[model samples]
Target: MRRHQLAIVVKEKEYTRRIADYIRGSSFGDRWQVSAFTHPDACKQFVKQGYGIDLIAAETDLLRELQPELSHIPAIALVARLGEADGQFELLQFQALPLLLQGITDQFEGLCRKPVKGLAPNTNGKGALVLTVHSASGGVGKTTLALHLAGVASARGLRMLYLNLEKWNTSGLWLQPGGDAGWEGEGLSELLYAIKSGSSSHTSWLAQHRKFHPQLKCDYLYGFRNQEDRATLLPADAAGMVDSIVKSGCYDGVIVDMDDGMDELHYELLMRADRNLWIVSEERSALAKQSQMLHYGRQKYGETFGRIAACSEVVLSGINSELGNPLPAVEAALAPIALPLVREWRRGELHPVWSSSLYRAAVDRLCAYLLGESEESRIHAVG
Candidate 1:
């Protein structure tokens, strides 16, 4: 997806830093590519010669200094205070960050410009981006969110494969019985063996064994059977399963649901994945486990410890209260993608959970990050 360019011109360097850092660490980081300019002329030069910016959010004083050639450019006034004299295009510099972002979103949407076209669907040739969903604590709704993410992306016309790497296969709970021949071919074990053994027909084996879930609009393997078979999974097995699946050019993205342990297989998978969603809950024990998990990684992997952290983001699940940040001192991107506890899901029905509008909206946000947001959303989504 093409990220829109934004130019932030505020003479106060601190102001620019505050806004830029917030956006960088927020979901907006993916939507906008922001550049800070302390001097007006530099910003003006960038606007005139470089590719034009999508929006110039600057102090009124800065905007006034620009030449008339830029008079018609999309712009918003960054002010210390709000007043009637200030047009709707003006945003207060001191308002809540979310409010300021909302103001920018509103003003930008109101612009009478060409629609922002979403880029073409992710081609299989691009090789699916591996997104691993993991948690330090179990029963945290990790697989559920992973499944929703895959379903949402698939619904957006992007091909997705939902793979469960769990030892006990918790994802099987959400999946209906007598469907897709669960664990029949003992999912991916043979495929991985073929890959490690250098069998040329491994790709053919993938297509034949995997079945499509009609509702998810996504494909999934029958899954692996027995802890003994799963225990044999090696660090190199990540490439054998995920990398091989991607190489097949069969899907745009692979959503991996993994167990809680940070074993060699888990480490290899997390490090190899393009993005990682580390699900966290409000419980103190869960948070402590996550913290310990990171501390352990830093100690065991040392120097190379932060690689996985760099690509990882926290996803808050079953959060019912207004607690500030779930991962204290943890840099969250876009308010942690808060998820609601759906009561209907307790009926032991997957359809009710999938159909829940609230659940779908939250998953949509995660999907927007994975696969670009839909055309209609590009035109009007506030968040």
Candidate 2:
């Protein structure tokens, strides 16, 4: 038996046709059986005839009229604009057709107890694992490691998305050949807007906006193109964006190259991530900054610190194998994963060189750890 049925009840024929067209062309159409009704009476009659309907989206007035009969099914009221409230169904003002359909689908899925077909069942019900690479000090090769980890994971057949949240990102220079040509659409700014406006089509929007990096063998969404756009992004907005991306179920792992400095959004992401890699350099200033960050996190977060600390790992970059005294406070908090500095890295090359070096082995170990695979298991399989 088909488990999902979507009924569209609206007064206007044009609106019904438009919505139906959008659904047919959307991801939802492949997974759902959709029906449209132009009259309230017709919809009620269809329901009265004992037809199975899992979800319904209707005009505000029609939704109110049919609420008593269709109270068992999940319903969403389509409003002309924002600010009007409806107690019956979640109020969604019609905006972009894709977003509208996505909003309705999200609400329907939440209300319907039965699982919908075609959507992958979240094994743990938390969706994808979000991994964040962050640092309080800059120039510690955070982006390099983040990209390498993502690339290695993708090569190992894990679906991954790399997101650079820095204010000024040179990801284009490294990931693409042309360097930001013909890729000038809204990108993260539009995504941020979609999240802020409570748009339901965040996943769809992301799918449409994401660009593939051939060399990295993974997909990525560009960060804010300009510095001016960075000011508008709030911490909650960033958190919401990440949540939507994870809930989309498009990737097995999402790697975030976070900006420097301890902002609310950065902390929120660290708290929410499945694993947080704090990259630091061996330089005195970088070590001092790392110590300060640790102290601040413990003092400010209190009990939440334990949860974040449990999932956190420190990686010390640009280090040579030498007996050097390190900060006791830093060393005690977390054992650092040592990533040796690569000579090719100084040439400012865009391509990744992971296949033929010790750095590659280090990155592979990191990847294995993130994927929860034991080194012994991997070795045994090889043997």
Candidate 3:
């Protein structure tokens, strides 16, 4: 395995030693070949000595002094205080070692913006993981959680395309208009239309309409503006679009935001998905609806539903913050994961940052788990 070279330059000898020790002892040791330096001069000497470094994490002073030499290498500025980033990437000087590692990893991920070359050959035939997020009930914060997961992954440098196939398509409000699409991209609507009309290849259509959301750090397709366009989406068309996105190699994977309908379309999506996230609120009605939906799926599809159910996990979403434990009995009862209610979101405040929020913290853990799980699945496919 050709590990990426990472250089850590900090004035504090002890801090550099601790980080080096942690990286060597942790899974990061496999991905990163760490070279620690307590002085900028030594680091400069090493760089001049023809040491190839993929990334550098250094104190602001060292990074500034070495700016002439590191004009090309991706660098992370270690800062002691929080202030305006001023369009420069930075990480706090002190943090949990794991988070620090994750931060650095995210930067590396952003650098490649594609499946790491090392992991691609040892995985499934698919170009990327397929994640379908659906629910038996609506208004359970499914889209929000899905977007946040994508955002967290994007922030970490893992790429994904957010596809909202919901009928009403409320998630469109969050995505900014960019890429070739600009403000009037009509991505999902056009793609579905093209699919139904059999006009062009999926790859061409996808590339033509895909938009980049700057804030979320993920590529996304804006939903159909017209209700009729959404109504035209067929089960096969939807599944085919997702499959194309997965095989397109345009992203690390696809996050399909599904509606609350228990129909043929939903079943096709769930079955095709590599990972299924069934989002449900704590409301008894929502839980009942989910149970009834499953019952019907099993009664109707039998063995097929069984396979989908086996690969699926029920996640508790919109857990009330008023509660002491947040998870309550639901954690043990249904969900291996729970998404907390963001009171700020109720007031129409979009999350601008992920590093500090409790909500982001939970999402970071979930994203890490999903990526790790996907990695395991990829390796298993190799076996």
Candidate 1 local accuracy as lDDT? 0.69
lDDT of 2 by residue, 53-103 (tens): 888777777888886877887777676643233334444555777666656
Per-candidate alpha-carbon RMSD to the true structure: 20.1, 7.3, 14.4
Clashing pairs in 2: none
Q: Is candidate 2 or candidate 3 better by TM-score?
A: 2
Please give, for residues 37-149, the per-residue lDDT of candidate 1 as tens digits.
Answer: 98888987886686778888888777777636577677777766443213324566767776677557545644532322343322222456788888889978887888888
lDDT by residue for model 3 (303-383), tens: 988888876778877677677434333221253556777667677555443433777666665655554554233221100
For each candidate, what is the lDDT? 0.69, 0.69, 0.70
Q: Assess every candidate by TM-score.
A: 0.61, 0.65, 0.61
lDDT of 1 at 156: 66
Which sequence of candidate numbers ranks them by TM-score, best first?
2, 1, 3
RMSD of 1: 20.1
- Which 10-residue window of candidate 1 scores lowest in summed lDDT? 115-124
Which ten contiguous residues of candidate 3 have the minimum total lDDT? Answer: 374-383
